[model samples]
Target: MTDHGPQPVERQLPTEESRALISLVRDLTQREIAPTAAEEEDAGHFPREVFGLLSASGLLALPYAEEFGGGDQPYEVYLQVLEELAAARLTVGLGVSVHTLACHALAGYGTKEQRRTHLPAMLGGGLLGAYCLSEPAAGSDAAALRTRATRVGDTWTIEGTKAWTTHGGIADFYTVLARTGGEGPHGITAFLVPGDAPGLTAAPPERKMGMKGSPTAQLHFDGVEVADARRLGDEGQGFAIALSALDSGRLGIAACAVGVAQAALDQALSFTQERRQFGHPVADFQGLRFMLADMATQIEAGRALYLAAARLRDTGRPFAKQAAMAKLFCSDAAMRVTTDAVQLMGGYGYTADFPAERYMREAKALQIVEGTNQIQRMVVARHLAGPGGAP
Candidate 1:
């Protein structure tokens, strides 16, 4: 059976402008992104032009302030936009999310002068960004990162390697976290380093199972120097800034997870109805119908959970716990739903001839990125039962 793309998702946006914006995104995604997703992903080609288009179209800067070339959309609206893009292509969606995460340290914590000088181009000047926090030995335990930034006169010298950095080599700027003092979280500090900074290099991109279109590689900061003016927030406060950014980043991951699950469900629905079994459409069978039902239900639940957390963030409420919960639930649900989609498709699902297999592989990464589901659980538990688990 020939594949049609995913069915339209009904969204609950806050305003007419937001609805129009989503329509624009949907049109752009269909015309530019979805049509080439599978082919480019298979070829492992990073769509830098598409990202440049996204930046020029104002999709890349949706949730940030308008004063600095952002779209000034609320988190609630911006996240739904993410869901739609992700449903089209995870590389574009997650790349936008990581770019937004990279901007967080500056938009939320940088000095007014810093914002004016850098935020505009970074947001809309066709510049891609990456976040550098995790290191070779510090994945989930980011507070234990070993990258060092030593103050030398007015310039700080950064020296160490960062692992698993998305857009590692190609970004225009990097939000880097380095230890400026002793060990642990309190010693850390944040810096906005130019992508072409001296002594900064990226190893070859790591071969990945999925989302191969997006590069993930180790960044080597071999005595990369930064002026004091690029420092974000107070010294010894980088870990807190990273955590704050992650609280919002997790919501982006949640929205992307829901998008993948929805895509898988749509694929399964289309495939089963066209493929017949025993002289009847496979979708006519009760067993496959139940599977489709479960997949749809999970997608709906994940959509709701992530939107709820986004609303909480938009309303200026405490949403760290809810963000962690959404990330954990949605990623797990995506994994289950995508797996079931493959099962419902039978043997055809296991092959690259179908998108179900790709969706399933992509879903697996969501459970591990931003924060592993295990780390998300710990974040939620700490919020619920205190850090010491003393109720």
Candidate 2:
């Protein structure tokens, strides 16, 4: 029953270069950070030191162009790095993903001059970013955002509260989406609001059930002034920029989901083998062995789905639908696989003695972030139907 046949495709090593980077990341995660991840989680401490190590390694901006000191790696390569880091610690993996998402708004839409101005500190490290799109009254219905930005002279004054900002107070910069015209997505504009901008205040961190180490808070912008030069893309292009960035951001979250599931699966496998039940190793039993098999199968499917989307993106095709599919399927798979991992561990999984419970909690957040899975389904469905088609 414990047949280790054909080693599932998900566990296979990547190409030489990818394998090298993966190995390096895995070693860094396991050696430098894993030991402290649990304790930090317990104490609700975010790993600033870990972020410094990642920044020093030039991993903070791996997918950007090399001209800006970025690694210029492919999404495929970058995703694996995320997976490894996440397997060791969800907080670091998610922080990096959110930071990357925060940067995407500008990287994808900013002018050459804007890129020149911001890419250096963003890609060179020491500065982190956050994406601000959601508001108190608008979430999944992002187009309904009521935050307003009025142009006065060469500066624009923004007044709004951005809810659920990943790096709300801690980020060096924020990519904020605000209404510049009438209602709806077409009226929105995007801006690069400095963290210390006038009237920008971070609300106290929200008390979440998991991922306590990755802070989530709201940004209160009371007449936060930003130069017109700081605007990203042309006026009214905010929705397009936001959607495009989310297409890539969803893939990052998918990678994180896979990583979380993988960690849970690995821990369960190791524990079942070493954790005696009845007589011989519990892994020797057929019933529990089937559970392991299911976990492996689901994880492989989830990875394949995201990789397919990533490849589609790298090829410059219309990959929005595929990205949504990956995000939805992989996140659901993570929620299921991690839950099963916890179940397979029986009582210990329910306790802090094991990481399975933590994995379960972490997996849940992935479903909600980067556009909730419900939003992902809508995106996919819209693509499936032709333009002007019914929902």
Candidate 3:
């Protein structure tokens, strides 16, 4: 049999159904998502149609409840699916993850009536979502957010600017975190606002260093009115809800980082075998061979780290510390692996003609998203050494 490059990964799925699902996702990636990723990203365009297709195919809502039209798959299965999609294109994989995060507040904390009212359409009705939490002043220090939501009887008016929001302008709905009480974490609240609400506007998408196909922008909520029913959870409960979503969201970012690293390694491996150096294949060089080994090792270690964290979450355990570790390790490893992949190609990798440079650019954003590696270390240290105690 002819080797068509690196074969598909053999995933450890919980069921035959999950195995079939991965197979379908892989086929879809090869046939649909992979072809235009580079060109589309170069143009800084968002593929809303592809997202619509994934939603229609039920791929976008895999980790949520089947009762609300989700696939009800475990995080392990769902994250592996994310890895596969991300290998094809980071935009799709990360977008799905963010959409799931946006849905988390309502799914986990909303009233039954609220769930029944919105979950079906949000999960399966081809409606994409954006998560709004990071403000211009509150990127890492999320609790210090200054966006305020003022309530007058039954109506709430939100006024503030949220930065680095994924799918900011194009999302069908946004899950917003705004100050509704006094100060600190307990004073915050989350609201589900429609994207087209009056006085809500988005700046032009940011000219990012990577993941250009994914629209990231500043969202301005200027007297945006929402009914009291749109508030997620209770007063003083928003910060906890946001943290819960972030813990899960970090896993998604980790999985996507692994996928990008794997893709970079695969490209380097294939190119080394094909390109001739010193009158022999480049793969024949011991120096190049060792680099490939290290890249593969980093990818494996990252995959194992994220999967272990996912298993913990799937089994109803506290996995926050592990999630932070996975996010820290995997995203940093991606930056390392992609940078090495670019080096492997000598001068060719520096140009956009090959995908190495593109992968390198994309890996960078993962290190900053979800939370910075600095924040991840802080989280892990707090869990490990107690608050502010490290020897």
Q: Which candidate leads the pack in lDDT?
A: 1
**Candidate 2 deviant stretches above 4 angstroms:** 1-15, 387-391
Candidate 2 residue lDDT tens string, 128-159: 88899998889888889999999998899999
lDDT of 3 by residue, 21-73 (tens): 99999999888888788889899888899999999999888998988889999
Rank list by lDDT: 1, 3, 2
Across 204-290, the per-residue lDDT of candidate 1 in tens digits comes to 999999999999999999989999999999999999999999999999999999888888898999999999989999999998899
Superior by lDDT: candidate 2 or candidate 3: 3
Worst 10 residues of 2 by lDDT: 1-10
Angstrom error at residue 133, model 3: 0.6
In model 3, residue pairs whose N, Cα or C atoms come closer than 3 Å (at least 3 residues apart or on different chains), thus clashing, are none
Better of 1 and 3 by TM-score: 1
The top-ranked prediction according to TM-score is: 1
Q: Which lDDT value does model 1 have at 8?
A: 87
